[model samples]
Target: MYRLHIANKNYSSWSLRPWVLMRQLDIPFEECLTPFESDSNWSSFRTFSPSGLVPCLEDGERVVWESLAIVEYLAERHAGIWPTDDEARAWARCAGSEMHAGFSPLRSLCPMNCGVRVRLHAIPDALAHNLARLDELWQQGLERFGGPFLAGETFTAVDAFFAPVAFRVQSFGLELGAPSIAYVERLLALPAMQQWCQAALDEPWREAGHEAEVQESGTVIEDLRRLS
Candidate 1:
């Protein structure tokens, strides 16, 4: 069986990706929940994860770190982890990769806090730019591929990649075009997503950094930020 190590359900957005993907795809795996307090000897993430990041996957001797890498690995094992169509798969991969690499500003301005509700008093210029780009890209994908998801009728890796962004949109009350809004609702309504959100709400341990981020409303700096 695959072993998946993840951080707190309340804060670690990266951790959410593979967990959601595997769960949604009905891949059975053992969950290893590691809290973020690594200074303590109890923290297991430091020892096994090469990058010391959550969402590390262990399948026997092989190890996969990074959420996208884990998702890619899953795609090798499970058909339809991405889209089935060649062109749709390519578009899905492009969208997923873009989500993995870009959107630093949205990530900063509105971190995912499933358990808490936050409202951003002001939209930073950089953040606004990112949102606008996301809106355009999202609309284009929906128009081109036809969705309730980024790719098509079924949920693909692209949806998993953007799932946290859905959390951000809802958590911070960020505005989006009607299609984008409906898409976020569909993402949020997924069974896996709902399970994660409920788990996040049930978490007893809180990270100070994440808590502070959720409480703070205005803008964010590069050194600090967050989600799903």
Candidate 2:
């Protein structure tokens, strides 16, 4: 059995990627969730993950770190990690890679906080650009591949890559076009996402750094998380 190490679901967007993918696809793995320390997780995480990062996969003697790397590692053994169609698979890889490497502004400006409803102070130019690009990419995939998931009729790695964005859009009330908005709604409605959200809301651990980042980004209108 594989052991997947991850952090708090509310704040760790990187952790969400592989965790959601495995759950949604019915891939078996033991989840080891270690909530972030109020101070720092570097020393603690280093014990299991070389990079001291969450979402590290331990497969027998081998270890895989990084969200994208974890996805690819799973894809090697999983049948439906990516689309089977040649063109769809290529496009999914490109889009998923773009998500892994790009979208810095959206990531920083609207950090993932699943249990909070926040009103942003302002949408900076960079954030606006990121949203525009997200809209464009999602539309292209849906139009080309046809359907509810990013790559096709079924969910793929690309959709899992953007799962955190769905939480972000909901938490910050970020606006997108009709199709993209629908896409976000669809993702949020997924059973895996629903489970993640419930776990987030039920969590009592709140790291100071993550809370500070949320306050820095915007005014938190509602905090649905359970009291610490």
Candidate 3:
């Protein structure tokens, strides 16, 4: 069985990507969750991850780091990791790569914190640009492929890559057009996503840095996290 190294369910957006992918696809993997340390996780994560990051995959002797790499690794051995149609597959890969590399504003400003609901002070122009692009991209995929999912009728790696963004949308109450909004809601309602959300809300440990970042964007109007 594969062993997946991850971090706090509440704050580690990167960790969520591969985790959700594997879960939704029914790919079996043992989860190894390491809660974040106050100062730095570099030393701790370095034990298993070359990049000293969560979401590293350890499959027997083979190790995969980076969420995209992990996805590709799994794709090599598993079916349904991506769309079957050549066009859809190409578009899915491109969308996944864009998510892996771009969206700095959304990634930084609207960090994923599933356990809380925030009332943002304001959405900056940069974030607005990102949101507009997100809407456009989602609209394109949905229209082109005709789907409940981004690529097609099924959840694929592309949907997993954007799963954390769904959490961000929920946490910050970020608004989008009707289609995108419905898309976000659909992602959120997935059984896998709901499981992740419950775990996040149930987590008792709180990392100061992540908590502070949430404050940088908005007032946490409600904290749904476990108090004890």
Candidate 4:
């Protein structure tokens, strides 16, 4: 059996990728969650992952760190996680890699807080740029592949890669065009997403950093700032 070590389900976006992929592929794995606290020890994670990050996967003697790497590894074992068509597979890989490497502004401004809702009072220019690019990408993918998903009717690694973005968009009330809006709805409707959200709702852990600034209307953020 595979062992996957992850952080909090409510906040760890990176951890979600491999977890979602595994669940979607029906691959059985043992999950271990490590909380993020000042007093939390890092030695255990460091020993398992060279990068000292959550979302580390251990399959027997093989160890894989990084969410995308783990997803790719899992894809190797379960081929259908990627597209079957050669051209579509290439495009899906590109889209997934772009999501893995880019979107820093979105990550910083809107941390994945599944339990809290926040509205943006003012979006920073960098975040605006990031959102614009994301919108463009989503539009292109939808138009090209004719989705409910990035690569079309089926959910591929691309969808797994962008799932957190869908969560962030919903959490922060980000404005998406028609296609993107429809796409988000489809993502939210997924059984795996529902399961993930249910798990997040059941978790009892809370942190000050995860708290949102609540106004009379709702929680709001004044500016976008990258956490790291």
TM-score of each: 0.91, 0.98, 0.99, 0.89
Alpha-carbon shift of residue 12 in model 3 (angstroms): 0.8
lDDT winner between candidates 1 and 4: 1
- Whole-model lDDT, model 4: 0.80
Q: Write the per-residue lDDT of candidate 4 for residues 16-103, one digit (tens) a residue.
A: 9988878877889999888765444377678778788888999999999998888888877887788887877888898889989998
Can you write out model 3's per-residue Cα lDDT over 1-228, one digit (the tens) per residue?
A: 999999999999999999999999999999999999999999999999999998899999988999999999999999999999999999999999999999999988999999889999999999999999999999999999998999999999999999999999999999889999999999999999999999998988889998899999999899888873
Instruction: State the lDDT of candidate 2 residue by residue for 19-60, as single tens digits.
Output: 999999999999999889987899999989999988899999
Per-residue lDDT of 171 in model 1 = 75
Candidate 1 TM-score, C-alpha based: 0.91
In model 3, what is the error at residue 139, expressed in angstroms?
0.7
* Candidate with more favorable, higher lDDT: 1 or 2: 2
Query: Global lDDT for candidate 1?
Result: 0.83
Give lDDT per model, in order.
Answer: 0.83, 0.94, 0.94, 0.80
Worst 10 residues of 2 by lDDT: 219-228
Ordering by TM-score: 3, 2, 1, 4
For model 2, the superposed segments whose C-alpha errors exceed 4 Å read none
Candidate 4 Cα errors over 4 Å, as ranges = 39-41, 212-228
